[model samples]
Target: MKFTATQTGKFSGPGFTARCVLGKGGVVKASQKREGDGASPAGTWPVRNVFFRPDRLDPPVTSLPLVPLKPYDGWCDAPDHRLYNRPVSLPFSASHEKLWRDDHVYDVIVELGYNDDPVTPGLGSAIFMHLARPNFEPTEGCIALEQNDLLTLLELMVPGAEIEISF
Candidate 1:
């Protein structure tokens, strides 16, 4: 329902309507698994929780709701580990692991549900709602936008904010 890094050209079909999902920030740099870089990931990811600017309190954390950080809260993207398709804790060492790091980027994440598949690692890992670049380009398998826009949407989002991406 929200867009961050939108392309300048005329987008057709699903991208033609205002209702169809759109991306705005970090678009130029977006990447899929094969392109090596500059491609947006494709899949439906469930909004896990919401994070807000600790200073601003007027807008209120409405959409999706906010869940406090927990010690065990994590999403697994490690292809080699046994917990490859599940959540794991810290102090873990692996070859293809992508645990939620302690950075502001992962602060507001929407846990993708596709990677849970038993057959594959479910594409890449660490997809989230991060701040967009100043130019508003593509992202690295994650949706992005200006910090202000993100906060505004967060305030208005519903409990089950779903991000469905299709090619």
Candidate 2:
């Protein structure tokens, strides 16, 4: 099943509808995506994989490939680097986003296939579906959900599942 999201924070799947928090800058066309724009790219993104903080919770129930987030796991966002938009080690020389966060947000992370295939420079990167704040605050450029709601979406998602976002 595909997960569809609206600007109003209602994220719905085939058999479920869960509230979600979108990017702080709101949703925009894929062409409008930029490095640090804080807008969620509007498009259909496949579920690439999942990364969870195993030390915090059990593995989520899902068919998509799952990997435990390492303390050194990070995503390089430095456009000039070859590893840009790819996972990197901590203490990385280039600009990167830490995956092993101290907060609960990265505890359950679902990689959204966004600007990763070719990893174009200046495009957005590190987009994901992750745990939302108690007040459902806006995200950097990801779809945020409550822990339980995220788990539910995970359980419902299958291999090749994609998320379609619109304004």
Q: Choose the strongest candidate by lDDT.
A: 2
Per-residue lDDT tens digits for candidate 2, residues 1-167, read: 68898779999979989899899999999998999999999999999999999999999999899999989999998888999889898999999999998889999999989998878998989989999988888999899999999998888899999998889
Which stretches of candidate 1 lie above 4 Å from their native place? 1-38, 51-60, 63-65, 70-75, 95-103, 117-119, 133-138
The residue-by-residue lDDT of candidate 1 on 43-63, one tens digit each, is 545666564334333334565
Q: What are the TM-scores, per candidate, against the unseen true structure?
A: 0.57, 0.98
> Each prediction's Cα lDDT score?
0.47, 0.91
Question: Listing every candidate in turn, what is its Cα RMSD in Å to the true structure after a full C-alpha superposition?
Answer: 6.3, 0.8
lDDT of 2 at 120: 92
Backbone collision tally, model 1? 18
Q: How far off is residue 39 in model 2, in Å?
A: 0.3
